[model samples]
Every structure is written in C-alpha cells, then in structure tokens.
Target: MDTMRDRFAPVMTELLDEDPRVAVVLAEIGRDGLAEAARRHPDRVINVGIREQLLIGAGAGLALTGLRPVLHTFGSFLVERPFEQVKLDLGHQDAGAVLVSGLGSYDWPAGGFTHMAPGDVALLDTLDGWTVHVPGHPDEAEALLRHAVAAGDDKVYVRLSVQTNAEARPVDGARFLTVRSGGSGVVVAVGPMLDPVLDATGGLDVTVLHATTVRPFDGEALRRATGAAGADVVLVEPYLAGTSTAAANDALADVPHRILGLGVARRELRRYGTMEEHIAAHGLDPHGLRRRITRFLDGAARGGS
Candidate 1:
C-alpha cells in the first residue's frame, strides 16, 4: 500500500520514457524519487531548485511549445505561492499543464500551516478550464496522472495525499462511481474521504458516490442518485469544507435540496500534532463525521433546513 506520492514518481518516470511530449517540472521537492528520471532525461525532467514560480513558469513554457508539462510540489507552494503565475501563464496564455500536488490539507501537520493548502481547489475554482482530480489511492492517482498528461493542452490538477483509502476504486478519470444506493440521501465522497464517509454512513439509508475527478463535477450522476426533489447531499472532501458545496448547489439548483459540506475548516489549527489529531479537530474522522452526518440527516428529515 504505497502512498499516492510514492506511486507518482515511478508512474511519471515511465510516462517520461514512453512519451516524447511529456515533461516534469519540480521545485526541489520529490527530487529523490524522480532523480533517475531526471538523469535519464535531463531536458524533460527539470528541477528549478525551490523556485515555485519558476517551476510553474517552466512548465508553462513547455506547454507553450506543445509539450505536456507536469508540475510537482506541495499543495500550498504549488498552487498558493505561485497562483499569480498560474493565473497569467497558464490561464491567461491559454497554455495547459498538469499541476500534481502532494501533502494535502493536513498530511504533514508538523510542516505547519504554510504547508497545508485546504483552499487549493477553491483557488483554482476562480480560474476557468481546469480539470481537478483527487484520487483516493495510489492506483487511482496513477490512472488520473496518465489521463491528465495524455489529455494534452488541457489544464489539469491532480491532488495527491498521504491520506488514502484501504482499497482502490475503479476510476475512469471522470464520472463519479456509485458505491452504495439508498433512498434517503446521497453522500458524495471525494478522494481519500471515501472510507471515512462509508464508515460514517454505515447502516444509514444514503447513497454513496465516489469522486476522483471533481472539477467537471458529475452533477448528472448526482441527479440520478438523488432522483427526486428536495434531495439531501453531504460532500465529504479532504480539502477545505464547502469547497464543492456551491458546485453541488448549482447541480441541484433546479430542485430543492440541502447540502452539508464537511472537510478541513477555514481557521488554522496552529498546533503541531499528529495528523489524526488534526483530522479529529476538523471533525473529519469517522466518529465526528458520523455524529455530524446523522444530525444533518435527522434535521432534514424532521423538516428542518
């Protein structure tokens, strides 16, 4: 059971060897993992030595030349620190690249709040034409990574994290997979939140849908799952809470619905503890989730908004 980041290196190295149009730009992180690839193809596998902006800039430059570039770094530095460059270079120029991020919202609690990027997806939401993939397992990560690189000229974000499900669900790079069917409500579990969501929703009459590609958000699938007016939806994500709530609201706009967004909260915890502690603090663990989800569902059923 390798971590998503652990699988990313070798999969990327293989992609570099197979595709002449594929390139990787790094910012001094994950260098050791892809060192062999860098040695094999110096021009294609590049490390910009801790310059986040340059990492994106170089990837953008490669994209402009018609080569697919995959940018790698921690979520905060990759998306937040160099956001201006991402906005102008990729979005403004219409150049496309694959931005693969590691160390999700609170994967490394000791790394401090600076390393945690709960708003990465939400920030990308401000931009247009970006595909975001949040894979729950290493295998799914590889699948999504290959799909993004092969898509060519499409801006894609593949978010990788240490938090993973015990098993890998089938991922087609798009569309949410229905894990369970129930009549009361639908629980949309994104990426690594699947196991916790399933655990939390145990015995509850709620349909569960697993999402890997979240940007193009499968509203149609959600529509099918709920199948009636005034549906109740709980989005269990590993990033910022309510990040996808608006998207869900828009998806169910025509119908009356209630949504509960659960994930990392807005405030910084500021304390360095175990990742499990952070999870518990954010109420994202199975125990907290069960309590919250049950309460929400109960309220909705009782005619409470």
Candidate 2:
C-alpha cells in the first residue's frame, strides 16, 4: 500500500498532465514531492521556494491569467503565513486555485508550535466561496483533488494527513463514511481519528460518521443519520471546540449534538510530538473517547429511565 504522499503525488501529476492549463506550485519541503511529480510531468510544475506568502500570491496571479494553480505546502505555513493573500487574492477574487495543505494538525514534531496549525479548517471555513475538505485517506485525497480541479469556479482548501491508513478510502466532497452500524448513537469523526473511534465503539450500536470535509458540512445527511439512529450526535475533532464542530451542529440545529475539541489550551504551545501523541495528551485518544461516548449514552439513558 502506498503512503498518503505517494498516492497523492501521482494522482496530482496525472491531473496536471490531463489538464494543460493547470499549474503546480510547490513550497519548501512539500516541493520535494512536487519535484518528483514535476520530473515525470515537467511542463506543469512551478517551484516557489520557501516564501508561502509569495507562493499563494503567485498561485492567485496565475489563476487570474487563466491558469489553474495547485498551491502545495504545510498546513500551518499555507493557512497562517499567507492568509492575507488567500483572503484577498484567492477568496476576494474567487481565484478557484486548489490549495493543497499537507501534514495537517501536528504532523511534524520538530517543526514545533510554529508549524502546528489546528485552525486551518476554521479559517478556511469562514471564507465565503471557499470549500474546505479534510480527507481521511489517500484515496479520498486523490478523488477530492480531481473534484476540486474540475470544480472550476470555487476556491478549495484540502487538509491532508502525513500518515496513511489502510482504511482510508477514496471519496469526494463533504460525504461522510459510516464506520459502524448500531442503534446507540452516532460518533462523527473528523480527520485521522476515525480509526480510533471505530475501535472504541466495539459491539455497541454506535454509528461512526467520518466527515472528510469540514466546511460545507453535510447537514441533511447528518440529520438523516441522527434521525435514523434515534440518538444524539457526538462530533469529534482535533482542534478548538467552537469552530468546525460547533458550526456543524449549528447547521443541523434540529439534531442535538456534543462536540469534543482537542488542542492546546488557549492555543498555547505544548511539547512537540506526533499527531497521535498530541491527541492522546489532550485526552483525545480511543480510551478517552470511549469513556466520554459511554458516559453520554448512559446519561441519556438515565434521563429517560
């Protein structure tokens, strides 16, 4: 099985090859992978060095000139550093450039707090006309890349994980993945945490909905799922609680929801570690999640009893 980066690189290369007008923009470390893709498909790649601000600006400029640019970089640099350019040049103009943000949510341990960006979803979601997608697996990343490229007139931000899992399937847009079937409750997972949620639920009638795309949430689907299960929906994410999960709950106001947000307190910097370690430290691991879900269900049952 190919790593998420390996699978995505080739698909992206193919997409660029298939479309003559599409240009690939590579930033710093992400440029290494893009370089390999460029070597295979030379005409479509553009190397922009380490300047994230300039990279996004160039991508936006290229888009204005009838070229579809796929800006690639780490999530933190892409969203935080070049936000002004993304907001003004991309969002304001509706440039339609595909912003591929890789290594999302504490992917690089040594990169430290300066590189850990948990708010990319929040920032991108707030932007009008921008589609924010967080693919759980490489297959979904590939599919969503194609969809974003074909979308033509809308800005797209795709959050990609560094590590790949065997369970990650190819999917498009904001569609959710049903990980378990049960009558107890619905556990909505965002990002790579879907695997753990499944493990925690075991034999319970807990249905896990893996939300690959955070923005433009599937409200109707959520309502249908919750209604069908006859249980409260619990949203799990690796960022601050008030952003994606809260917004999603608001979108489906008819359904009751509980949001579990995981991140540094007050956005403070913590010890650097892998994504799993970070999640575990914040009580976002499988055991913690299981306890919370069980407690929620038990409390709900008690109220009824």
Candidate 3:
C-alpha cells in the first residue's frame, strides 16, 4: 500500500520538526511530497534532483557538519548507482547517516533490473559500521526508523517496500525475537520473509525467529535458542541468497550445524513480470519455500548430503 510513502514522509517530517540535528537528502524522489517540511525548515530538506552521487556526497557533508542526514530514494538509485559515493563519501570520511531506501528487491519489476536491488544488503555488508534493516511491517519500520535516526552517529540502511508481514512483531536493534518454539529446527525469518517462513514451517516442529534489524545479526540470541537441539537453521531472507552465510557460521561455531539459505535468486529471471511471478521463479513464495525446506529437512534427517 502506501506504507512506503507514509513511512518516509510523516515520520521524516516529525523527526525534522523535533530534531534540529536532522536533515533530508533526496535524489529527485520525495522532494515534492515533503515540500512543506522543506519550506518550514528551509535548508534542511534538500532536493538534489537525480544526481545520486551528489545526493550521498551532500549527506556526508551534512553529517560532517554535525547534522544527521537521512537520504531517501529507490534501492538501486540510492545504493547501487552511487555506491562509490556511499563508500568514499561516507565511509572514507568516517561519517554516519540513515540511508532509507524504497522499492526493494523486485518491488518495481516494471522498471527492470536497473530499478531493482537484491544485492544492496550484500554490498553494505562489505563496509564497516553499517546496520542494515529490512522492516516487515509499517510499525517495525517506524520503530526502526526512529531508532536509527535517534542514534545519530550510526550508519543505518533501511530497505522499505510494499512487501510486508500480516502483523508486527517485537523489535530491537540487535536481538532476534522468538515467534514459535519447537525442537526439530529453527527458521530465522528476516523482514517480510516471516509470513512465508511461517507458512512453510506450519506443520513442522521447529522454532521461528523474527528479525527486522538484520545486520550485526543477533548471533548471541541465535546461539541460545538453538543450543538445546543444535537443530537445523533455515535462514529466509528477502535479499540475495546466503548473504549472511558467514555470519551464520560464526554464530553457530563450536557446534555441529547445518543451514539452508533461501532468498532472492542470484541469477536474473531475464524477463519482466509481476513480483509474484518473480518470487515463484526464485522459489520464495510460500508453497515453493515450503517444498524446498521440506525436502532439505528430510534429506538432512536421512544423513544425505
């Protein structure tokens, strides 16, 4: 729905009004939608029209001057095109910002690969000090947004889109909240993957853990939850498959473990269609995920490679 728009506009405006240290940088998007906030604050809400590099550069400059800049745009334009700027401008300068992106994964399938960014999170993982968040619901988004903005000196990237869970779950900056408990395995659902993960594990005896704040992943919590059975872990993410494989390994170190990673396909479909179509092809839909997870769990139980 309008969760993407509403999350940016109203919450941003409120943050701007309450915090003088906050500023906005737009890459030709959300400029007019926040016109009044720009008018009210004059120099804070900047519309850097289409120049993605300059948009990030400007945000870095603002941060250097003791202002917390919140940059907004679609995922590809915000992170991919201007990635060098994101690295050199903010990272090199040792600056921090809240880079909030809209239209995640294939949210804008009509716009083609140029508009979609399934690798943004993986890219951010390369850098230091970034806290990536993929909110599953509007409430989770708002809470995470407020927390990121208030943090001021933290480097945060929030991916917002139309995909959402049916309801909200308890959220924190660096902890995985358990949604269901069972002995067979643990299904870690990141962001909107909660719905599909839940559906896939419905009949299976497993533990389900939810996470909106993914990066700096809740490794400690993960260890504790899976300690008893040392059960299987099925990480279902909304971005690239196995992006957090290494982190999962580190978290489960010192114990024998197995993990099945599910996410957006690394290979492109090479055809444009609806989000549902793309999801089905990638085996991310509930039914598709269920089949894959079921087979994996069964094979693992049988001691098959």
Using all chains and alpha carbons, the TM-scores for the candidates as numbered come to 0.98, 0.89, 0.98
Candidate 1: where are CA atoms >4 Å away?
none
By TM-score, who's the top model here?
1
- Cα RMSD of all models vs. native, in order, equals 0.8, 2.7, 1.1
Question: How many angstroms is residue 299 displaced in model 1 relative to the true structure, after the best TM-score fit?
Answer: 0.7
Q: Give the per-residue lDDT of model 3 (tens digit) for 200-220.
A: 889899889998888888888
Summarize candidate 2's per-residue lDDT along 1-305 as a digit string, tens digits: 56455655677778776888888887776666567678866666877788889899889988998988888887889988899998998888878798887676777877888877777777776678777777767787777878888887578887787744457654668677676666766777776667767776777787778887777777766676777324566777766544666665665666555544443334454677676777676566778777777787887778731
- In angstroms, how far off is 149's CA in candidate 3? 0.2
lDDT score of residue 251 within candidate 3: 90
| Pairs that clash in candidate 1 | none
lDDT of each: 0.93, 0.73, 0.88
- TM-score of model 1 (CA atoms): 0.98
What's the lDDT for residue 11 in model 1? 93
